[model samples]
Target: MCLDVVSRLIGLHKLFLFNFYPYVQRFLQPHQREVTRLMQFVAQASHELVPPDVLEPVLRALVNNFVTERNSSDAMAMGLNAIRELCSRAPLVMNQDLLQDLVQYKNYREKSVMMAARALLHLYRVNLPTLLHKRDRGRPTEASIELKVKQYGETDAKDYVPGAEALVNDKGKKKTKEPAEPTEDNSDSDSWVDISDNEGDFEIDTDSEDDDDDDVSLTVLNNIIVTDKHISQEVSCVQVLLGKY
Candidate 1:
């Protein structure tokens, strides 16, 4: 974990230890979760793992790798974040070449990398004596929108002439009428006709004069009856009729 050991590891060309750049968060992905445990361990023990002497060289290697070798935008972003962390933690370790690389990276095609580069540049400005004017030019600012308008833009309102008229076709014009929609009354002989039943013939009464009509109730019923002892009932009815008379 010490700087001397990390430096020796970096020197070993066959090992390619610098390939595991922190800029891309997926550096440990190729290792299939094995490198993740080691990264976590290093993070937890970063103070004890990497000594002051090794920090600069390790950061330099990381910056150089991302700037040259790593093609992934994500990795470049992560590396830029790591550079910022290193600059904040130990600004003196950041060299001029590293600062210039970050500045150049501000225009990276990947938005994440550009943002990270801008952040790293800001940190560099604080830690080192970078030009102040480059800060605004390095990354877009709120004023850029207005500045762009000032450069190559126009307003929605333009100077108008009082007598201007829209173009009209006057050559070989013919008089034409649009077909009218068929009404429910079917008054027009050329109008559309319905083939179905006369349900469409019903008129919607909009006249308010019929609103005063009284309400009416109507009901109809049918009934059926059967009898077998009709003679006894007829005799009883005749006797009662004679007594009443």
Candidate 2:
């Protein structure tokens, strides 16, 4: 009935209720069920409790107790739930240090504590964007490009494949290609080519031969017979050049 009366007074005479905020702040200590109940009432009507200045102190006190004191599991859970509610309803009223301290409970061994802490963390994260009111920067205005290059160092030169990393700079060093294996045809030195000098044309060495070899000998023996008339003089000149008798 007393709690009922207080709730009624808070709803009806909210202006007067604001005046008693300091008294509530001073009296509400850790592990106090009555004080926790009153806080819950205020939290339930948080939206109507305008000018959040008073509520911030009250919630901060409860959070401080929840984080630092050895309150009952029920009380701790209540505090966590109330904080989640406060964050959703009035995020600006939350204490940053208290939220940071409460986050530690997410890693607590107790399943209920961990669960409650995680829920609160989720609530906080969900509302963070709203609280921060970040601008809708469709994308990063400043262009940033990240480049990663990996260099492998070989301790032994023998392990390096020839020309594999030729373009790669290695402390001002250059690598050359390995010599190709010799083939059988190119390995032979005394290969010969047929020579024909008196056929009205010269023959070039098609096989491996030294550049100085020019063995060409032709002798015209008798009167040269011409078949084509237009090129007859030209043919005679060629025959005379071949030492025609």
Best by TM-score: 2
lDDT of 2 at 238: 50
Per-residue lDDT tens digits of candidate 2, residues 1-245?
Answer: 56456755665554446655555566556546576666656554454335557678777766767644477676676677767765565565665566666777877767777788888776755544232212211111111111111112212223222332222334135355568977888767436656677776775666666544453221211111111222344434553345541
Q: Per-prediction TM-score, please?
A: 0.36, 0.43
Span of ten consecutive residues with least summed lDDT in model 1: 217-226
Residue 144 error for model 1, in Å? 23
Predicted structure with the largest lDDT when compared to the true one: 2
1-245 in candidate 1: lDDT tens per residue? 45335534543322334333343234434224443343332232233223335456556555655544345787677667766765554455556655776778788788999898889777655434443345433333222312221111222342332112111111113334558977767767556566657878767777886665443211111111112123324433553345631
RMSD to native, candidate 1: 35.2
Per-model lDDT: 0.47, 0.53
TM-score of 1: 0.36
**lDDT of candidate model 2 versus the reference:** 0.53
